[model samples]
Target: MQIKSVFIVEDDPSLQSLYEKILSYYGYTILGVARNGEEAVKMFVDFQLKPDIIIMDHRLPVKDGIEASKEILIYEKKAKILFASADKTIKDAALSIGITRFIEKPFDISVLIENIKELIDVKI
Candidate 1:
């Protein structure tokens, strides 16, 4: 149950690119990167690419991460989402939706890697 495919929903271009490159280095195949929830949903549908895990930003345009995650989960119940955000309010919202793992902004990359590894392990 290796986590090979991943989808990242983030608005910041630099962060998005950094995530992509870092994850790729760790041997995870990137399914796609979406700047907003709407684009995320559309890309998920259009590609029919079901990623093993999703790393999502809580604050997004068109739709927030919580809303997008719920919508995505409606179709893919086993979807594992990791919420990454700077806002405490967003963390609360994510927790309300039963999201267990969250990474605060300005996080250490090593810490993120460990967290991501643990998340994938739990899902498997």
Candidate 2:
């Protein structure tokens, strides 16, 4: 199977860097990073080749992750989006829209990595 690319939509710079590093180490391409929901939505919409997966954060400026996820899925129904967030309340709402999965904030890096791998299998 081809290597998968991942788009990160987190507002925290440190977390973004960490995810980028770990994903790169694991052989997944880092498609791009968006600092907020609005940017994430725009990046997904504008990209010629959509990333294989999206790592999204719930709290954000301009737009929340839930809305952004909704918008992206509207365009690409099968896109795998991992909604990683500290806000657990959005879990049900996010899952309702067909996000691949949710990984809670302050999560073990191993857990996140495992989820990404699982999504990759699904994609394949």
Q: In order, what lDDT does every prediction score?
A: 0.83, 0.90
Per-candidate TM-scores read 0.89, 0.95
RMSD for each of the candidates:
1.9, 1.3
| Worst lDDT 10-window in candidate 2 | 115-124
lDDT at position 8, candidate 1? 93
The lDDT of model 2 is 0.90
lDDT of 1 by residue, 1-124 (tens): 4657888999999999999999999988999999999888777767666887789898899998888888877677777788898886677778667665788887988977787778777853
Q: What's the TM for model 1?
A: 0.89
Score residue 103 of candidate 1 by CA lDDT: 83
Leading candidate by lDDT: 2
Best by TM-score: 2
Off by over 4 Å in 1: 1-3
